[model samples]
Target: MQNMRIVKKPGYAVDSVDRALQLILLLQETEWLRIGQAAKALGVAPSTAHRLMSTLVYRGFALQDDQHRYCAGPALHPEPAVGAERALVAAARPHLEALAARVQETVNLVERVGATARYLATVEGPQLLRVGNRAGTILPAHVSAAGKAILSTLPDEMVSAVCARQPPHGGSALTAAEMQELQAELRDVRSRGFAVNLGRTEPDLAAVGAPLASGNRPAALALSISAPLSRARQIQDPAAVEALLTCCAALRLELETQGRL
Candidate 1:
């Protein structure tokens, strides 16, 4: 325990505010937290933890579910600025171009909107039978590789809410069995750190995608390599997955570094 020396600062921290901020950070790291867990983590009494959590809930920084578990609130993920979409596209253009060059396939940057994903930017590959630009097209999130990549990063409840509000575009409502199957696929995507759409969005199209994380937070953005189904067999190829992941990492690093600015 010699390595655990405690330093007492003179005039820096306030205990209550510090504890509240710590709770917020904890919420960021996990899907949900209970009062007992928060109290134990912060070395506070249960009453104190309850008070702190109540304050957060009142201020919209946290939400208390029916089970009394605390989860992050909408306030934690603020809406982007007025022209933020354009800025995102501008920052991502070069990276998308590089990815398309490396993978020899069309690359796209997509943003999640409700239950749909809207293409924000795209870079086409050199292949003659390449997928076309989808810069402004919107598609069902459950059927798009990029959408699945982004969705896999969200909590189950939030995903369910989005699905409930905006069921798939052209199909009958999703049955409970279908929802469970989609959840399983998202779990697989989470485990593999990427997602694939094998002719699900369009019969002739296939793609592989990975989510972009900003620090510890999952961004609403994803990047994908799109191609004709014939060439898209690469979706399952380890080499192709590696290439897509590499590009995703590069883009994530750039976004993180720029965020500091």
Candidate 2:
């Protein structure tokens, strides 16, 4: 975190542009914003707020739902997960269970929190020698299977912004060369539709992961399956990959049904 605070606006800032962006920020914070609420927040008239939001809707940055309340639009959200991570995880549990059962490995639901991937849920497989549950575990996004999997879906500049920070557990920031290497790996992940971590997180653990929804908007969450390194190959086998992708399809539909995709 920075040590000192800078003013919200510089002396030469443009008021209209700043206000428009402020409305966007407000939409990010609030699940559904009303015109009156926006006006109250911006210190502007209701009509002015409506006009500004209407313009946002026209540009696909905001949406006016059937209730005439405003919400962040596809262009602005792309993932529908601002302040909704818990809901998304709740919807994903069943699918994770199905995947774990099918693959007989530990399944993890990971949310990308800046440069770290926080495990939201986990389902352990039945094998005697299997990867343990990781619900609530946090790992460097760059070094995590699910994290790298989701990062592959973003643009290079955005990836840089995400991995530009230090690891959540405490470490130096990623260097430029490391970012380049990770970007290269991400390019491969994008083409393959999955990512792998071979004993990267633990000495005896290996995993495979992919974005929650492929060929669509970027997802804030990813699904991964882990197994003991001695038997990790099974998780990457064709059957496991097929099961994982099939589960992703089902989970994506659930999210869409909830208006979260």
Q: Write one digit per residue (lDDT tens) for candidate 1, span 12-97.
A: 78989999999999888888789999999999999999999888775556765424677775558767652565566788899888
Best by lDDT: 2
TM-score of each: 0.65, 0.66
- Residue clash pairs of candidate 1: none
Report lDDT (Cα) of residue 222, candidate 1: 91
TM-score result, candidate 2:
0.66
Residues 1-261 of candidate 2 have per-residue lDDT tens digits of 869966676889888888899999998888788999999999999999988987777555675532457767655765645347657667888888888888888999887878877677788998888877566456788887898988988899999988897654456888889989999999999888889999887888899888876465677878899988987788889889878878877887788788877
Model 2 gets an lDDT of 0.81
